[model samples]
Target: MADPMHDAPRASITGRALHVFAFPSLLIAACLTGFLPAAPAFAKKPPPPVLTAAAAAVPDSYSAAAAKEIFAEGGNAVDAAVAIAFTLAVTYPDAGNIGGGGFMTLYVDNKPYFLDYREVAPQGATKEMYLDDKGNVEPDASLVGYRAVGVPGTVDGMWEAQKRFGKLKWKQVLAPAIKYASDGFVVQPWLQKRHDYAARSFAGKTNFDVYFSGLKAGATFRQPELAETLKRIASDGGREFYEGRTADLISTAMYGHGLVSKQDLQRYHAVWRDPLTADWNGYQIVTAPPPSSGGVGLIQLLKMKADLKPAFDGVQLNSVPYIHLVSQMEDRVFADRQQYLGDPDSYKIPVAKLLDDSYLASRAAEVKADAAPGATGVKPGLGDTMPERAQTTHFSVVDQWGNAVSNTYTLNGPFGAGVVVDGAGFLLNDEMDDFVTKPGTTNQFGVTGDEVNTIAPGRRPLSSMAPTILLKDGNVALVIGTPGGSRIFTTIFQVMTDLFDFGMAPQDALAAMRFHHQLIPPTTIFYEPYAPITGDLADALKAKGYKLEGQPFNGDVQMVRVNGTTPEADSDPRGAGVGAVFPLSPSK
Candidate 1:
C-alpha cells in the first residue's frame, strides 16, 4: 500500500555532485608529488553490483541512470522508456525536450507499435510564409527565432505510450525527471560545445543566456523553471503542456516572433500507427512509417542490398567496392523517399510499391559495384523524383519481460529554435524547417524536398528519425536507433549491417567507421574518422569519380542486441553516453 516512486533508490543531487570532485585531497597530494592521479580520482563511481533482467542504452549517462532506477523500481520496458525520455529533457537539452516531437517504435507482448509524435505545423502556417518575393527561401527564416517552432508532441506521445502499455503510474514514471530538474545533476563535458554555441548565437537577445550561460563542466547545473514546468505536468497530465498554464507560456513566448498559438498547442495530438515491418532474410525489421521517411528508406535500402547480394559478395565493410555499392543503394533509397513519402494523414504515400520486390529488384539492377551513380543525382523510382539533425537523441530499452522500446526524439536542430518559453523552461523545435519551404531550398540539415513535404496547416513535416527493432524467429534480436539528421537512416544501415551481417561485437559494431550518401549530391560520400579512408581505399573511391569528405562525427547510436537470454548493449562512443546491462536486484 506504500508509494513506490518515493521509495525508489536514487542518488541525491548533493551526493551525486560530491562524486564530481572525489578524492580532492588525494588529487592535491598527487599534484604536489608530481604523480598523475589514478582513474578513480576523476571517473564516476560505479553503480551497485546487482544485475537486473532489464537493459537500456541511452545518449546521456544521467538518462541511463534514470532508466536503471526505473527498472529497479519494478517498471516495465515501456515505463522505463517513458522515464528516460523525460529525464533526457532535463539533462540532454540539445535534442531532448517536451517542446519538440519524435517517433517511438515499441515491441511489447510480441506486438509491434509505432507512435508518431512528430511536431505539426501551426494552423496559421502557409507554404509561402518563408519564400521571398523572387521565390528564394529566406535565410535563417526557418532555422532560428520563434516562427520555426511547430506544435510539440513529445509530452503527449510519451503519455500516450505509457497510458496504453506502461505498468507504472504516469506520475511515478516522471518523478525522477522532476527531481533532476529541480535538484540538478553534474553536467558532463560534452554539454559545453552546445552551451557555448547557444550562448554565442542567441545570448541575451533570445534568452538562451538566461538558462544556459552559466553551465560549466562538472558543475551541479540546475533548471528551476524547467523543474516547475515538470512539476505542473506531474500534478496534472500531458494535457498540462497542451491546454493548461504551460500552453499559455508557449503562446505568449511566440506572440509576435513565432507562429504557434495556444490553439495549436491545444490541438496537438500524437498518433499510433502500424510499424513498417518487412522480412529481410530470416530477420524481421520494424521501424517508423511515413511522415518520417526513415522506415521506408531503411527497408528499401536493405532490400536493394539483398537483391544485389551477388554484387557485394567479396567486398569488405568499408572497402571502395562496398562503399560504392552501398552508395548506389542509398542514392536510390533517398530518391524514393522524396517522391513517395510524406505525412500519411495528408498524403497517401506509395508504401506498398516502394518496398515491393519488383520495385526493389529494379532499383538494385541500377547499382553497379564498379562505378558511382554518375554526376547526375539519382531520381526517385516513382516518376524519377524526392527529398531532414545529427543533433537529436535516441535510447533503446528491453525489460526482463521481453518488452523492448527503441525511441528517437529531437528538436530538429541543436537547442532547437534557440529560444525558451519565458516562464516554461523548454526549447521549441525548429521542425517547420523540416518541410520544404521552397522546392529546391535546404533546411538546417542540408536536405531538400518537394511538395510532398511542403508546409501546410496542421501537416506533420517529413523526418528521417528511424528508431528500429530487428527480430529473428519471433524474438527480439536487436534494438537500435541513432541521432543524425540526413545521416540518420544511412548511419543506422551501416550499424545494422555490421552487427547482423559482419558478426561484430556490440561495442565494435557501434564503434566501427561509417559512411553516408543521401543522393542530394550523389557524387559525394561522407566517412567518419575511425579507420578512416586514407590509402588505397580513398584512391579507389576517387577513381570511381566520387568525392570524399571527412565528417568528424557520424551518429550517436544506442543499441541492445539480444544474444540468447543475455543482452549485449553499447552506446556510441562518439557522444558522451553509457550502455550497460543495468544491475537489477532480484529482491526488487
Candidate 2:
C-alpha cells in the first residue's frame, strides 16, 4: 500500500485507522465540515480606538479650535494651554487676557507647580480706595468702576509660564490669537448680551471706537489693534508689553481713566508660589494658596466631609440635609479663610493650624449629620460662621512629552469695566476692587470679607476663582477649574467629588446640575434639574427643624481627566473644546 500519511489517496487503511483513533467516523466528518472554527478559537480581541486622548473647550469656540491646532502641531499640554490662554485673551477678552490675571496649577512630569498671576493693587492704591465719606464700605458698583482698575499681571504671567514651561516658542503659541483678533472673531450669544449693556462704556471712549466700531450684538468683531499688540508681544516677548511703547500707552490710558500709574505697570510681576495640597484618599490635589482661599477652604471642607465617612449614596445634591452639611462645612472654611488667609508675604498664616487634621476633626465633630446647622448654629472660626473673580476662562492640556497645564484667566467682569485702553483695543480689569475696602463689609458674595483681605497699597487681593490640578501616585488624574466668581471653588469641589469619589466621566460630572449653599443663605440654590430633589430635601430639613428656601444656582465647569491605566484625556462636556494630545492619535 502507498503510505497513507504521505501523498496517497484518501481511501487508505492507515487514514481510516487515524480517524478511528481520534474519533468515531461521524465526529470526524462534523469536525471537517462545521466545528473547525470553534475548535481553534484562541484569537485575541482587538484594542479600543487608538485616539491619543480627548479635549474640550469651554465658552469660546474659536479659542477651543486654537487649542486643538496647537496639539496637532506637536505641542505638549503646556504649549496648548499657553496657546489657549493667549487666544482666550483675545477672543474671550471679557473673561480672559492681558488685561487681567489669575492662578494656575500644573501637573507635569509627576510634580505640581503653582503660578500666581492674580491682579495687584497699583502703587498709588490706598486702603480707603473704596470707602465712602462715612468710613463705610461703598456699594459694589462704587468699587468696580474706572477707578477700581488694578495693575494687571496676566500678560506677564502667561509669558513667564510659556518661557519656562511651554514647549512651543512664544510666537508659535500666539499665532492663533493674533489671527483671531486681527482678522475677526464672532461674538457669542452671552457676549452679545453683555455687550449690549456695556456698549455705552466702550462707545464713550475715544480709543474704544477703533475696535468697537464694527462690533454689534451678535456680529463678528475685529480687534486689529489688539491683534497688533499680540503680534508685537509674540515677536518681542514680555518686553513689548512691560517695557515698550505699548506699556506706555496702557499706563497713560489707565491714568486717564483714573485708575493706575506707570509705576504700577513697571512693578507688576507674576508671583511663583508653592501650591497648597492635601492628601485625600491617596490623591494629592494642588490649588491656589492664601490671598485666595479656594484651595485651603476646599481642603477644609473635604476634611470635614471625610469625618462622616460620608456615603451619601442616594442623597441628591439639593437635598436639605446634604446641602446643609456641606454648607455648614463651607461656612467654617470661609470663616477660617477670612480670618487667616492673606498675602502670606505680608502676613503670617496659620495654615498648619487651620488645615490640621485634628483641628478639622474637631470642627467636623460639631455638625449633627441629621440636623440642619443654622447660620448661627455654626460659629465663625471657633466652629462655624460664614461667607465667600474676574470674567474667568479655564483650559487644560496634556502632551506626549509629559507636560500639562491647568490655567484659569480672567478680565474682572465682562469686557472688564467696559474700558478699553486708548488705541490699544484691549479691555481693562476692575480687579483693584477685589481687595476689601473695609474689614467687616459685605463682599460680592453679600457676605463679609475678612480683615486680612483688606486693601493695601500695592497688595493683591484674595480671590475665590481658583484653577487646580490633581495627581495620583505622581501621575496627572485631573486638570480642572471653573469661571464663576464666588462659585468657582464650590463648583470645582463638587466636580472633583464626582470624578474621584463616584468615578463619573468628566462630561457627566460637569453636566450634573449642582446646588450651592454658601452658609450665608440658609437656603439652597437649586438648578432646574435639581428640582426633583428639592421637595424631598425640604421635607427632610423641615423634619430636622431647618429652614429652607430655594433659588437658582448655576455654574460652568471645564476639566480634563487622564485615565489611570492609559493616560486618556477626558474633557468636560459642559465645555466646547477638547484637551489636545501631542502626536495625534485617531479619535476614539
lDDT of each: 0.80, 0.65
C-alpha RMSD (angstroms) for model 2: 18.9
TM-score of each: 0.89, 0.82
Residue-level lDDT tens digits of model 1 in 63-181: 88888888887777888999999999999999989889999998876667678888999999999999889988888788788888889999988887887677667888999999899
| Winning candidate number (lDDT) | 1
Q: Per-residue lDDT tens digits of candidate 2, residues 89-116? A: 7766667778888887776544566778
Model 2 CA deviation exceeding 4 Å by range: 1-51, 54-57, 140-143, 197-218, 310-318, 375-377, 382-390, 522-553, 565-588
lDDT score of residue 564 within candidate 2 = 49
Residue range with the least summed lDDT across 10 consecutive positions in model 2 = 12-21
Best by TM-score: 1
